[model samples]
Target chain A: MKTINTRRTIRKYSDKEVSDELLDRLLTEAARTQTMGNLQLYSVVVTRSMEGKERLAPAHFNQPMVTGAPVVLTICADYNRTSTWCRNRKAEPGYDNFLSFVNAATDALLYTQTFCNLAEEEGLGLCYLGTTVYMPQMIIDALNLPKLVMPVATITLGWPDEQPVLTDRLPTASFVHYETYHDYTPEDINLHYAAKEALEENRRFCEINNKETLAQIFTDIRYTKKDNEAMSEGMMEALKKQGFL
Target chain B: MKTINTRRTIRKYSDKEVSDELLDRLLTEAARTQTMGNLQLYSVVVTRSMEGKERLAPAHFNQPMVTGAPVVLTICADYNRTSTWCRNRKAEPGYDNFLSFVNAATDALLYTQTFCNLAEEEGLGLCYLGTTVYMPQMIIDALNLPKLVMPVATITLGWPDEQPVLTDRLPTASFVHYETYHDYTPEDINLHYAAKEALEENRRFCEINNKETLAQIFTDIRYTKKDNEAMSEGMMEALKKQGFL
Candidate 1:
């Protein structure tokens, strides 16, 4: 509970290298994370070399952490290996569609988060790159990912360079529904988000953006519709090519 | 590391009811999990009543854990609240699409896993239901989920009544590549899964099913192509109705 409750997303990293042995130890242990029917439909590409990081940076929109961290782990939703196993054993495999993709993606994400939890516990700093899905085509090319495999997300890892304060979350009520989903009424939304909106950092962000409400900073600047749609279209096309669509 | 390393999936749970306060505390702590651009696009439905679990059980194919566990959490890929924030703050929102769905699903999964980790650390046991996506429409209606909200997965939680032994995983080398995805060769597959295939339990499973190999068990029975395609079609239709397609 202590390790999990105090965990923070780490963006900055020192120059110290993460030893291969440590990476192996954490990963081998995290491999115990529960998977779909125990198929283990996921893979990871560890990027430590200069060329690998440089090539993969643009896929994450050139996030500095890509190059700064000693390792960038590209977690892939992969089913090729399992399909190969079936074929080798004289059985036909049918995991090439959207449902199969969903299953594999689920496996990949569970594996990714478990690894992150263990890595954080080992004193490693890390950041998740959600950009991996939006520009998956770029990742596919950069990482030579074949059909039936896609990078779900990437994480940059190293020793921490700085300490950042923990971020605030909405009151538990905002997110947790009772026996059934409690749809948010306007009043419920306000009640749930009151403390977060009242935070000093949120107020500062609103002021910095010259916005009346902190949420405007999100809608008008942080996550615009234009960017989201453009990325969405690209994602659909990539999903098609990867044979998930 | 020790805790996470030895963690196993728990399907059998004692009838001890989880307190509401404990659930709230763990969830509140878990919401600090990093999200896409801090958008925190997820919500969870907590089911503790027998009626609630029974309603959701069919969606999970009535897995015994669904009815046995004291609590069932349906974690959702949510955007309604965030979009509401945008509109209330006088900003246009464009998250009713597939790209946004991916982001929110990623957020929801991370949140659920973090909560599971904390719950496990607090000496509770849990198992994730992969059936959430297969019958999402039933889950949507059962949970009264609104548009822009879809169940990503369900996890059953309770005090453990059984201590399941740890499951095995593929060798780290089979899944971990350097610089790029390392496609599996037949020899590599054999080398990686040799111990698993040679296990007495697996060999017994093959013999019981009259299968030539362990892989045949999956292809022929566990995850057949016929079921996958049927489920994928249904899922696409459901996603479209939910405004994500």
Candidate 2:
């Protein structure tokens, strides 16, 4: 519980190597996490070699953590192994569809988080790369993922080199609804975002970016309309190519 | 750590109530979870009243846990709140797309797993209902979920009335690959699944279903090709209707 409350994403790592025995132990324990129908529709491709990390760095936008961490894990939503088994047993596989992709992806993510929590509890540091979905083709090529297998998330892991402050979040009331969703009104939106917009760091961020408001920093600079549309198109194409569309 | 390793799904619940104070505390702590850019991008709808549970029961295929548990939580991927704040701050929103939906869904799932871990640690029991995505339109109507908001998962929570055995998983080797994905061969597949197929429970399951093999039980009865295709179509329609296309 304390680990859940005090956990922070670690981006920087020391030069310590993560032993195979420890990594295997943590993953084995995390594999005990509950899954849908006990299907366990997920797999992880671990990259510990410097050459392998370098191959994956471009897909992650060359983030320092990709090369700096001792271990880089590309967690995938995998139906390949399952489908192969089904075929061998004379069962026609039906998991090459969109809903199946969502199911497998959910399983992969849940397993990733469980592994992350266990890793953090072991004093290992890690950061999740959001770029995994942005460029799936490159990751697929780099990791040699076949049909029915798609990378959903990437984590860079090693011993901690720095302790960062916890990130801020919207108040509980902002995200929790009773019985049903209570749509946010203009006043409610303002009240919910007041503290976040007023943060000194956020104010400085807008000033530095020449933005009019904190929200503009997100909409105009961080996650722009043009980029989101393009990325969405690319993701759809990748999903189709992977036979999940 | 022990919590993660020993946790099992709890579908049956006692008559004892879950205190609102305790629920809020757990949620607040779980909110500390890491997310993409700290955007959060997720919401939870808490259903406590019997009428609300009954309304949602059909969506979850009338699963007894819907009405049996002390509380049901519909965890959602939401971009409405953030977009509203952006509009209020003189910023244009552009999150009505698939990539944005994926990001929000990932955030929601990570939060769900983190909350489950913490809840299990506190001796509270919960089970995830995979039916959330299969009938999204029904849940949308029941929860009054608006545009840019989609329910991605559901959890029923309460004091445990039954202790289920730990679910079985394929060997870690089946899911973990070093450096790159080593595609499974027919021989490799047989080796990987031998233990699972050899289980007496699975053998009995196949017999009960009148199936030739374990995989036939899943392909023919549990997750059939026709059902998966139909559900995939339905899910895509719901995503479009929810403005995530």
Candidate 3:
């Protein structure tokens, strides 16, 4: 309970190196997370060398954590390994489709979260890079991923250098609907996001960006529709090249 | 680590009610998981009523766990609340794209995994329903989810009624790669899956299913190519209707 309550996403890391033994233990725990048919349709690529980090960093739009953390782990939605196993056993495997992609991706994400929690429990900090899906083609080339294997998410991990403030969240009421989804009225929306919009940090951000509202900074600058569309198209292409279309 | 190691999917549940207070604690822990850009793009619909579960059961192919558990959580990738907040603040929000869907889905998944782990620590058992994505439209209608909110996953939770055997998994070396993915040779594949294939349980399953190999059971029956294609199309349609295309 104490560990759950104090969790935070740490971006900056200390110089202390994460041991291979610790990583292996954490990974073993991660593999224990629930999986579909116990197939465990995921894999991790460990980038420890400077050259490896440099190669993979651009795929994440050069996020500082890509290079700053002691380890960069790329979590992939993988069927290649399983497919090969089945083929060798005289079983024909057919996992090349969108449904399969979702299955593999779900397996990947669950394993990733379990690994993150275990890492935190072991006194290490971590950051997830969402760019893995957006620019997956680049990641595939960087990681040498083959057919039936696609990068879905990535994480950088090490000891923390800074104690960043825990970020805010919507009130539990705002998200926890009873029995069924309770569609938000305009009033409900206002009530739910009121505290977040009024935060001093958000106010500073809006003003600093010369935007009239906090969301303008997001739409106009950060995750604009134009960029989202392009990235989505790129992801589709990557999925096709990886034979999951 | 203990919590993870001993975890198993519990399909049968004891006739015990889950308290609201305990559910709240688990959710709070879930909200602490990492988010994309600090925008928590997810919500959950909690179902405790028998009628509600019955309505949701068909979407999961009438899986007994759907109605058997005391609590069912339908986790969604939601952009509605955040988009409304942006629009109300005089900022144009544009998250109607695949990249945004990926972001929201990732956020929802991490939160779900955290909640599951926390619940296990508190002595509850759970099972994830992958059928949620395959038949999302039925879930959308059943849950009354509005635009910009899509059910990405579902889980049933309660105290255990059965202690199911833990399932098997591929070796860690089969998935983990150093710096790059190590595509498996036929020999590598055989070396990796030998134990699983030699298991008496798997051999019995192959014979009982009238399949020559275990993978034949997956491809020819459980996860057939035809079913995968049909379901993938259904999911794509749901994605468009949810405004995440």
> Which candidate's lDDT is highest?
2
- Weakest 10 consecutive residues of candidate 3 chain A by summed lDDT: A1-10
Query: What is every candidate's C-alpha DockQ against the true complex, given to 2 decimals?
Result: 0.78, 0.87, 0.80
Residue lDDT tens for model 3, A1-245: 35667878888999998999998888877899988777889999999999999999888889899988899999999988878877776777788898899999999999999898888888899888888888889889988999999998899999999988878887889889999888778799778878988999999998888988888988899999899999999999988999999
> TM-score of candidate 3's chain B against its reference?
0.98
- Across residues B92-204, which tens digit of lDDT does each residue of candidate 3 receive? 88899888988999999999998888898889989999888988999999999988999988999999999988777677787789998888998887777787778899899
- The CA lDDT of each predicted structure is 0.87, 0.91, 0.89
TM-score of chain A of each: 0.96, 0.98, 0.98
Best candidate according to DockQ: 2
The per-residue C-alpha lDDT of model 1 at residue B4 equals 79
Which residue segments of model 2 deviate by more than 4 Å? Answer: none
Ranking by TM-score: 2, 3, 1
Retained true contacts (fraction), each candidate: 0.82, 0.85, 0.83
Output the better candidate (1/2) by lDDT: 2
TM-score of each: 0.97, 0.99, 0.98
